[model samples]
Target: MSRVSNMVAEFVATFPTTLRPGVLYVSGAYSTAAHLCCCGCGHEVITPLSRAQWVLTFDGTVSLRPSIGNWTLPCRSHYFIDSGSIRWARRYSEPEIEANREHDRQLLADARIDTPGGRHPLIQYCRSVWRRLRRL
Candidate 1:
C-alpha cells in the first residue's frame, strides 16, 4: 500500500459517512507547487463512501491542478506512475489505516501552512472539531 493511500484511509475512517463508492483520485505528486507529494509506489489512493477502507488502486488517474491542491511534490522519486497511467485498486486493511494515521499525524505536525496543499483538509477539519468541542 502507498503512504498517501494509507493516510487517505485514516482520513475516511475518522470521518464516517453513508455515501457509497467513494473514489479517491490522486494526480501528479511531483509538481512545483506546495507540499503535495507522490509516494512513487505505483499505487493510487481510493476509498469508497461506504466504510473506512482506503484502497490502493493501481488503475487510477492523477490530475494536477493549481486551483484545488498541489497534485505532486518537488521530489522526482514521488512520481510513481506515468502522467496518465491508470493503476490497480485494493482495499486497505484496518491495520494499515492505524499505521497510516500515526504517520499522517506526524506529517501534519511538521507540514507548512503556507504551502497551497501543505495543510491537509483532515487536519483543518480536526482542528475545527476540537474548537467546537472546546466551545461546548
Candidate 2:
C-alpha cells in the first residue's frame, strides 16, 4: 500500500467541480466528505457522514472512523484517514471482503429499523415472533 503524505483538509459548502488529490473536502452542510483515492488511483471517494456510516471527527485535525475500503476498485485500497494522515490497513481476502459487506448491510438495516418512522412491518413481525418464541 502506498502512503499518502502531506494530506490537507478543506471545508467547502459544496464539493468543487473537480477534486484534487491529497486534499479532503468536507461539507458540513451536506454531511459528507470527499477525496481522491489515497493510493494515487485518482478515484473519487465520497463518504457520507452518518451514525451508521463514516463519522468525521475534528480534534485540531480531521479524522474518520472505520477505515475506507475501496473493494470495488482495481487497487482495492484500504486505509484510515486520521488526523490528516493516511494510515494503511492490511489487505483483505475475498471472503473477508464479503463478510465486511454483509456486516455493513446489517448495520444499515438495523439503523433503518431504529429510526423514528417506526420499524418496517416485516421486521416488526419477525421481532414479535422471536419474542413470543423466547417466552416458551
Give the range of the ten consecutive residues with the poorest summed lDDT in model 1. Answer: 47-56
In the range 22-88, model 2's lDDT, one tens digit per residue, is 8888776566789989998888899877667777776658788889999999989999988978898
Global lDDT of model 2: 0.78
lDDT of 1 by residue, 40-105 (tens): 333222222100211122223433211111123232232222223322234345576467567655
TM-score of each: 0.26, 0.80
TM-score of structure candidate 2: 0.80
**Overall lDDT per candidate, in order of appearance:** 0.31, 0.78
Best of the candidates, TM-score: 2
- Any idea what lDDT model 1 has? 0.31
Angstrom error of the Cα, residue 66, model 2: value is: 0.7
Cα lDDT for residue 89, candidate 1: 35
